[model samples]
Target: MISGILAYRNIQNSILNGVKIPHSTSQPLIFGENGKYYLAVFVFFFSREDIEKGLVERPTMWAVADIETGKIIEIRQTKNKEFSDASYKIKYNVRADAQYDTSKKYYEKAFAILDSCRNEIINTDRFNPEEYKHYLDMIVANIPKEYQRFYFDLSV
Candidate 1:
């Protein structure tokens, strides 16, 4: 069985390789469906130069990946009109910002797909909380202190 931490790393690497651009990813949220694990994360695209200048652009997108294979199943811009409808319009530039708004839908289409598949939010049977915490700590250590706050919340 794949551990949640391993799945998270695999998916993260897959996304990084696939994007081929400077970006930052939110903490992955893992779920299971049809006996297979999956993960969803928000990605903020920006240039490496922006980091040195302390000006990270905030164009956000979201992706879902198959944990076992680390293949991205779907990825879409959060501001894409194709995914937005009258009932679910894009009002926030960031997924984290949408999380607090009770009036608007956040990742409505992606969540619908998962819901259709009967996806169950999970942390995986083999998840080791202690190890995962250590992993996160290591990751945070490399990030500048001013930017470290973004890694703390995994609600998305």
Candidate 2:
């Protein structure tokens, strides 16, 4: 049985090894529901130096990995057009202003929970959509209301 954490790690490593171009970092969002696992990563194609210099308008890649059968069922990347220059500017301001510190802390907590429970999520013999949905609902209930919408938008 492939646990959610194992699935996340499997896909994350795949993206690190198979990305089309050399990437500096990958910030991942992982979720498990309906007896399935999802791994989503926002890939930044910037060097450490570029980020240090405050360049936030670079192109970003979205990688989604669907894990099943203890393997990656699907892995794909989508170029997000909504992250335009204006969006980057907003992101830069948000980072510099520290207004999202609370949000960041919450997200980090969620990630920690998922990351720490790898061994507990045993692999199942078959996919169970209802079971996953139930688990997903529980996960969603724990998130702050402000970030619930964003969490639901992750469809990978």
Top model number, lDDT: 1
Span of ten consecutive residues with least summed lDDT in model 1: 81-90
Give the best candidate by TM-score: 1
Candidate 1 residue 87 C-alpha distance from true site, Å: 23
Across 30-138, the per-residue lDDT of candidate 1 in tens digits comes to 4344554566666666655655555554435667776444467977675772211212222222223212322224333333333323222343335444444554454
TM-score of 1: 0.45
Local accuracy of candidate 2 as per-residue lDDT tens digits, 50-135: 55755443335545555332244444444433322223333231023223333645645544554443223434333344444444
Off by over 4 Å in 1: 1-37, 47-49, 79-126
Deviation in Å, model 2, residue 54 alpha carbon: 3.5
